[model samples]
Target: MGSVFHGDITVGYEDEGSGEALVLVHGHPFDRSMWHPQTEHFSRAGWRVIAPDLRGYGDSTAVPGTTPLAAFARDLAGLLDHLGIERCVLGGLSMGGQIVMECYRLFPERIRGLVFADTFASAETADGKAARYAMAERLLREGMDGYAHEVLAKMISPATIAARPDVAAHVLRMMTATPPEGAAAALRGRAERPDYTGLLSRVTVPALVVVGAEDAYTPVGDALDIHERVPDSRLTVIEQAAHMPNLEQPDTFNAALGAFLDALP
Candidate 1:
């Protein structure tokens, strides 16, 4: 674990291995630790893996006020600059995928490739926005205690919960540990993210889209839509997994990711 000061905020990150860089962003309510499997795997395969706790999630600074989703992207750009990386493949899961899209919008030149995992490319619908706002309010009012368990079924497959108690426990711990303010800020910010459908059509780099076969949040159809729009992209679906496939099925997720990284220019 290391720390870099991106302006006033101190972004906590884990940097490992060497060679080509691969920056993996964690999803909503989860910290950089969520990428432990990918970080170790890819780093061992001769890639520099950097995973950061987006401001509010991990040890990173929390937002005192509402923060735009783009702020997370800007923080990423700053982290790359801090590391003197000119360009690299950028990957994100769930909300992290949205952040990667924002990063591509703001610093296209800095992104050599893209990876979208269990995520979507559309803006939040009117109903979705309302739901997000409601969630934010609920988190603020009740915190993450029971709320983490409430969403665990949707985040991971039923098989995982029944067969892998350790994994289930880890996911719950990550979610429950998240600060309410940070989670709320992220929820509100995500509600306002721009539609990335048009942006996907313009992606020229080698792209990989991976989704759990049973992801309820984004769903397989959403991943297909993204794959259809992005010209140079391949899609992989990990069976028996849900939203967090990388955690639930690390070996399969890493296999798909490894092939993508190997084929990159």
Candidate 2:
């Protein structure tokens, strides 16, 4: 684990392995630890794997004010610059996927390929925005205990929770440990993110879109939309998984990701 200073915010990340660079971004409320499965696998397979805790999560500094998703994108770009990586494959899950799209919008030349997992390109609807704000308020008042329980079923399949108690517990711990201020800021900021459907059609690089078959938030349909719109893209659906397929079904997810990396120039 290492730390980098990006203005007032300090970002924490894990850097491992060697060869072609591959940066993996974690989703909202979770930290870089979530990518342990992919990081170790890909690094051993001859690729540099970087997993960073976003500004408000894990060991990174927390911002009190509203943090636009674009801010997260810029932090990623800065991290690449700090490491002297001119261009590398960028992969992200959930909110991290949205952040990758924002990075593409800001610095397309810096991306070699894209891995979008369990995410969508559409903007938040009115109802969705309202819900996010409501959640934010609830978190500020009540903390993460209730929210963690509410989201657990939607995050992983029932079979996963039953079969892998450790993984389920890890997920809960990650959520509960997240700073309320930071999580709330993210929720509010996400409400203002731009629609990336148009951007998806413009992506020309090799892209892989993966989703859990049972993903409730961004379903398989969302992955198909991304694959169909992106000029050079493939879609893979992991069975018996939900939102966090990479964690729920690591072997399958890593296999698909490895194939994508191998195909990339």
Candidate 3:
């Protein structure tokens, strides 16, 4: 684990292997450890993998209050600048995917390709915004343990929880261990996310849209929408997996990602 300071924030990251860069962002309520499988697999496949724990998660500095999506994007851009990487294949899952879209919005020239996994391209609905705000208040009031237990099944499928105890435990650990202040800040920021449908249509780089067939959060339909909107993109849906397919079915997810990376220019 290496870290780079961005003013008051210390971004904790993993930098491994060599060759073209592939920067993977972890989703909300989770840390960089969530991408351990991908880091090992892709780094061995001759790619430099950079996975970072967002400001409020993992070993990074925690800041109370809102952490806008653009803040996350700027942190990543700053990390790349520190590493002297001008470009990379940027990818993310869930809220991380939305952050990647914001990255593209701010720094298109720094991206060689795009990967959107188990995520959506729409803005938060009025109902979603309300729920997010409510959840933020709940996190601040009650802390993350209760929310982690409640959302564990939703984050991964029931089948996954039953069949893959290890993945289930890991996912639960990430959520429960997350700081309430940080998680609540992220929730507040996410509540105001803008629609990325128009932005997707303008993406010129080759793109990969992946989702779990059983993902209840984003669903396969969300991936399909992204694939259709992105002029040059590929879509892959992993079976027997849910929102966290990369952990629940790492082999299948890695195969799709590997193929996409190999095909990229």
Candidate 4:
């Protein structure tokens, strides 16, 4: 395990193996541990795998300021620079994917490939950003207990949830334990992020658009759009999974990833 210092803040990161860099960014309410499957596979496959705890999530302590997703991207850039990595493959899941897009926008030269799983190009739609704002307000007002229940119910397909309550419970616990501040800040960032459609054209890197078959949060249509729009991107959907496919169906997710990475020239 290795780390990179971002000023007074010690961004807790694990840099393992020795080949092209592959950075993994976890989603909202998730710590670096969320990438356990990815970390193990990528590192052992000879890629220098880098996984960091987003602000306030894991051991990497949060600072006293606005922790918007854009700031999260900057934090990623700082981490890469701190570790002396010039160019690498960047992948993000859910809110983490937004951070990766921001990273691509800010530092296009440093990206070799893109993987956006269960993420959105925009958090708002015809109803405007109210839905996003309301979600944050609900989390702040109702706290994690209510938020956890609501999200857990929506995270997986009803069939999957019924078949494996224990797994569902574990997943719920993971989100519930996240400090409300970080979760709320992430929601706010989603409602406020600029539209990423314009930037996709300039992003010629090989890309993967992964979505869950039952992901009601981020529509499958959006992932299809990503596949069609990104010059060299492909879309793969995992069945019996919802928003967090990597958690609910890790084997399927890992297999897709393994095939994709293996195919990369």
All models, RMSD in angstroms:
0.8, 0.7, 0.7, 2.2
Off by over 4 Å in 3: none
* Backbone-clash count (model 2): 0
**Top of the candidates by lDDT:** 3
Model 4, 130: alpha-carbon shift in Å? 2.1
Per-residue lDDT of 172-247 in model 2, one digit per residue for the tens?
9999999988898999899999999999999979999999999998999999999999999999999999999999
* lDDT against the true structure, each candidate: 0.93, 0.93, 0.94, 0.80
Q: Give each model a TM-score.
A: 0.98, 0.99, 0.99, 0.90
Deviating ranges (above 4 Å) for candidate 1: none
**Model 3 error, position 255 (Å):** 0.3
Overall local distance difference test of candidate 2? 0.93
lDDT of 3 by residue, 84-151 (tens): 99999999999999999999999999999999999999999999999999999999999999999988
Q: How many angstroms is residue 22 displaced in model 4 relative to the true structure, after the best TM-score fit?
A: 1.3
Model 4 stretches astray by more than 4 angstroms: 1-10, 63-65, 126-128, 164-166
* Total clashing pairs for each candidate: 0, 0, 0, 0
Q: Candidate 1 has what TM-score?
A: 0.98
Error of 2 at 71 (Å): 0.2
How far is 37's C-alpha from truth in model 1 (Å)?
0.6
